[model samples]
Target: MASSCTKLCLQCRSLLCSKTVASTWKYATRAHHCAAGTRIPVHFLNGFSVLNEDQKTTQTRLRWKQQMLYYSNLSAIHQTTEVKENKDSEELSKANVVVYQNPLLPVDAVPVTESQMSLDLDAAAELSALEEISDEEAVGISVPFALPPASTSLRDYVDQSETLSKLVQLGVNLWKLEQRPNVGSMLLRLNFNTDVAPRLLFLKEVGVENSRFGYIITHNPFILTESLENLQARVDYLKSKKFSSETVASMVSRAPYLLNFSVKRLDNRLGFYQQQLQLSATNTRDVVARLPRLLCGSLEPVKENLKVCEIELGFKQNEIQHIVLAVPKVLTANKRKLTQIFDFIHNTMKVPHHLIVKFPQVLNAKFLRIRERHLFLEYLGRAQYDPTLPSYISPERLVSLPDETFCVQLALATLDDFYLFQKTL
Candidate 1:
């Protein structure tokens, strides 16, 4: 039996391999390959096995021509094996995706594939015995070794398929993430190839702290040429860089929210928006995603009389199925004018007794207060611009509107001791 199997291995090898492959052997049961990948068992069709029982059991195997049906079955089995190998390769690639660094993952190493599978030497000999069946004797030959067309270069093909699949997954996740307001455009932004591998290794070394972020990294790996951690470390080395979490949060709040930018700039927002833009219901109360219907209700419809247009105002998740309020391009531009108009309130225009937010919102006859003056601008800015309020005192008709991004840039740009936006506000 061993001798017969050995003869079959030698014979079938030529039919199975490239002419370049130096004598491909049926892998010995005891022989091992360090990176053999995986092998799977395939059950032949029951009917084929039953019908071929006599032929399979026969010691004097029919020449290839005499056993066309058996050869056809063998060809089918080979094709199935090829498909199985491709699938195994795909799965192996997925599992070995380098996990991001954190306590969850600690190190990086080579990818491995293993399976407790053994191929029958008798079956291999049976395949080998088919090699002697000449094409004329067999009626036809099915060449398993007839390689696929050489259109896809070996290196490029592997990389294009593997890396592209992983990258596509990453892009989809990022698209989903962009729907959230704060971090819509956040992604690794890989600039180079050399940078990618190390960054991937770093993630595998550190393990991503945020699993969502980590998942993105594992699939679409990127390495920053310069470590952000090192930059953060150097910041502390230079000065007392650390601040309280509360302080940071407060700072962010005070850091000039660019609510009203240009309509053109607003149009540019599609690029930034991710799919998952989760905002806390508590902190950002009465969250206004876009503008109200008082802006453009006439264009859409007359649902619940959108004239003056503010439906679903007092909502609690129920009783509200989205109100397609008019997007207020006019109010946005007008409210922008109000920033300067609010500032102009102290010197230029007179604040009416009823229009409290026009100037000194929180008591005292003067335009400013001692304790509340620094933060007073924020309160008045919102009060003067709050779309919900029934304000006959419109700052919309002002001469000039402050550019919100410029206002933000100007506000944050300088290291001035005093608030620069105070003048603009």
Candidate 2:
């Protein structure tokens, strides 16, 4: 049964954000089970828009028809890769991890070699050991004079630069210098690494009247590299591939360049990205689609009911031929929770056009310049979207958005950083 397409909940977000005017996401289309013991027929959040219900047999088929609200994450490692699936690929189910840190030891005292319960104590240790230091080489940003007013914080833009700014703004020295050349960019990276880097966002309206509508937003979008000097090399990596003109332009325009890779917490790595690859197929001619729970309350309900939940989704593909190029070598320091939180944060604000046009294509570019990479694995929010308002935003607010369209706003912020690309205008 095909569920009818409906408008997304933008009112709640606008009321909450009260500022900011833009957002984007990556979506892949593929097929997969919705929830255990639940065959909810809806689009998959990872990317696939059409679920291969044919695969939904009496045992493997979906039972209920639910709408999914997806926020795509283009930066995640696997989503960027095109992994070939062997029907015989091994699947690990129910992998559990237990931690045994000494109660007497402060959380920070747990050593990298010791935190086996957490996936990457080494990475955590690396993160904790990072000192609060600013790079003398600050990069510059040439905005079009009309960057949307900070009326809405970055959280208002995608996740939580809104309140996070409040924390960073407390740093009068850094906050006041943003208008200076290369200062804003340098400070943004600095703030991302500090205690202020761990974002805190509220899933409002989740009160007793709307518990199901609210969910948590995680921090993500981390930079793999620390210096802006790496931007040139990263851009060169993309330009070697010969991408489309539009791809090159967007990347160049957003340059300086920062990785700001997003992560999510997952007990199982294979399980998480598996869904990413499959659901992403919907945008193309994939065989099936799996939907997430984007909406609820029967067609008969007519009125906005609280039974529905909306989730932002993020999906990215590197192309079937280069599928092998996208898989990430295990980061000796990477953590499972970090990855999961990145996913949650990425999707929460991933824009729709991201994968349909930019992500893969940019990788195809022959001349790309990456100026910076911000590695953030922080917590953001747990909020709900009201399924009743407009789904699309007005183009006036965001030149990237469609005209007169009511937009779907993500109640989350990204753990990623704002990447700056370069080329002569």
Candidate 3:
């Protein structure tokens, strides 16, 4: 039994030695190919020829452990290199991204260091520890102009001189200054005695009231920038065209931008109106003074309305002049609206253009209101508008009177009836 057991042990040891040699030989061949030109130890190649069988097995086990450790460390180093590469790529992509910033918002201050923050805290503490001084003990520091309190409006800040103060008293407020900052800044740089006062005095000399100075300036700030010589020239041109000083003042006050027109431009506008309306110089001055805005914008609207009156509405030249003289607004009224009103009056109401000239206010009333009232009157059989008739209802009163007044006075109907009629329409 002992001999058989010894034989079994020897056979198992021989089998283990054969497997270890085979694995070692395979590993060494692979390592030689992978390392290319690396030298192998003589004992490793010779398969531990000098060592005994037990020693050879022990050395084989140690070599296998060392190779396994080397492979694990190599895998760990490869994974670490890939992770570092990925981290660097992510940082580069983040650097390429763009961030947007709004121009209107205030920029953030630089980050405060710990030492700087500590110093700031110390400074604040020292400041708080300082004693407060009385107003009498405070030193008076004179500046070019006294800055107003922060609580006051921007106008207060702008009113640094007596001239600016006078403007504030008149009517220029913070809103007006902000709306035209360029003009406000220009005024600030101007000398009151040399630049602004002369213009104020000129406006006054032209007969503009002191109270109107604010209104004029607020409406047309460019008036301040106009040279006194140019302003005088404009005023002189108006006077030369037979405009009285009071008429010129009224025109300027009503349309503060009037003096901004050059002498040639003013003459051209006056001549155009005179020629178009067949007005004498006196009548032209009166018409222009009544409606100064006529010379303000483009004359294309005026020309179109004139064509509408003559060609479309079939008004003669003289009748057109009478209509304009009565209501100067007729010249600037929307062409289509003017035609609609004239069509309803001439064809629907059987009123003549001659009658419209006398009561031009009919053209200014809303078209729907005119239609409702006229239809109501026609329904009652009291729509007689002829002056020769006994129950003559003037075209002016038809539009000018309120609903209640028209119902009671002109229509001879109750307010309820008129309101009911309007709703039905």
Candidate 4:
């Protein structure tokens, strides 16, 4: 009986040990699965029924500790992952950054030192100071007020009574000033005593009459802006071109814009007329002195007229030169009118080109007048232009004589008869 009891007791002890070990094994497996973020099997929890009350309490406490440890480990892992992601994002941002470099600087250029930089600044300051001093010296005195901006209107300065008074004293009336607001605006900026008076004095010295100052300035206010030296140089150039002092003065008075032309321009114009017309220097000077405005306009008309006189009118080069010497304005005459006059004289009047050259003034007469007179003379059987023939009329007398004089003297008829004859045409 005793031997049988011992074997049974050992079997019972072995069964209890196996149950405890199985329960512990299941509990450990569940904790491991929970920690690994996997699902805990429901069968693993059933093993806890085999345990005693004390063992169950201890097993419950162990499970609770394991769950807490598992959650703590999960939080640590999640924080580590977030830190890694942030580090990667920072690296990507660093890769995307761009750096800029100036292309103008030389690759080997040295950075400027402080001393050199300070010296450059000082030199710039000195240059600006010197410029200011030079400006004061150029004006010959300190300016009382700031000069008006370039865009300021002349009307704005019109309210300034002193400026208007000075302009009035110079004979530039309000009407004249209004005629050229641009000139008046520029004049408003000038110092009257230093800038304006000197130009007036210079004009006087150049033989521009004092009485004509108002006319000259009104016609060409820009003359006041020209430098004295330049005005003198232009006068000298005219004198050098064989124009007398009085002739130069008279030319300036007649054509205020003539001096506005550069010396080279005047020379070219004189040379062109002289070379084209084949005139002597003295004759060229005489022509320009008589017609100063000839120097002002384009030479193209003059050129076209020369070609017409030579090619169309059949005037020899020498004959053209003679005509131009007699009538300097003929060079600038309308090309079509000139052609018509030549056509009438040559084709209708049977007048020779040489005779036309002898009286180039005939070219200056109105075409209708020339035609009427020639037709009248032709009616009278007195239009014989041959110098060798009897009762031959010079071309000059044909056109130059007044209507009454032409009828009685050249046409050899009464004025009433001439008028009657004109009505028939």
Candidate maximizing TM-score: 3
C-alpha RMSD by candidate, in order: 26.5, 42.9, 19.3, 24.9
lDDT of 3 by residue, 299-380 (tens): 9999999998899889899988988888898999998899899889999999987898889889888999899999999999
For model 1, how does the per-residue alpha-carbon lDDT over 93-116 read when each residue is reduced to its tens digit? Answer: 443232111122112211222320
* lDDT of all predictions: 0.31, 0.27, 0.74, 0.72
Please give the ranking of all candidate structures by TM-score, highest first, separated by commas. 3, 4, 1, 2
Supply candidate 3's per-residue lDDT for 340: 92
lDDT of 1: 0.31
- Scanning candidate 1 in windows of ten residues, the lowest lDDT window is 23-32
Give a tens-digit lDDT track for model 4, residues 1-425: 99999999999768655423543454445445543343222233422312123423554545445454443343343344444554566653332221102222222222445554565566566545445466666678655754456543455565464655666666765565665557666667677777778988888898889888877877887887888888888889999887888999999988888888889999999998888777888898999999998998888888888888888788888888888889988888988888888889888988887788878898988999999999998888888899988999888888888999888889778999988988898
Q: What global local distance difference test value does model 4 have?
A: 0.72
Model 3: number of clashes? 0
Positional deviation of residue 88's Cα in model 3 after best superposition, in angstroms:
45
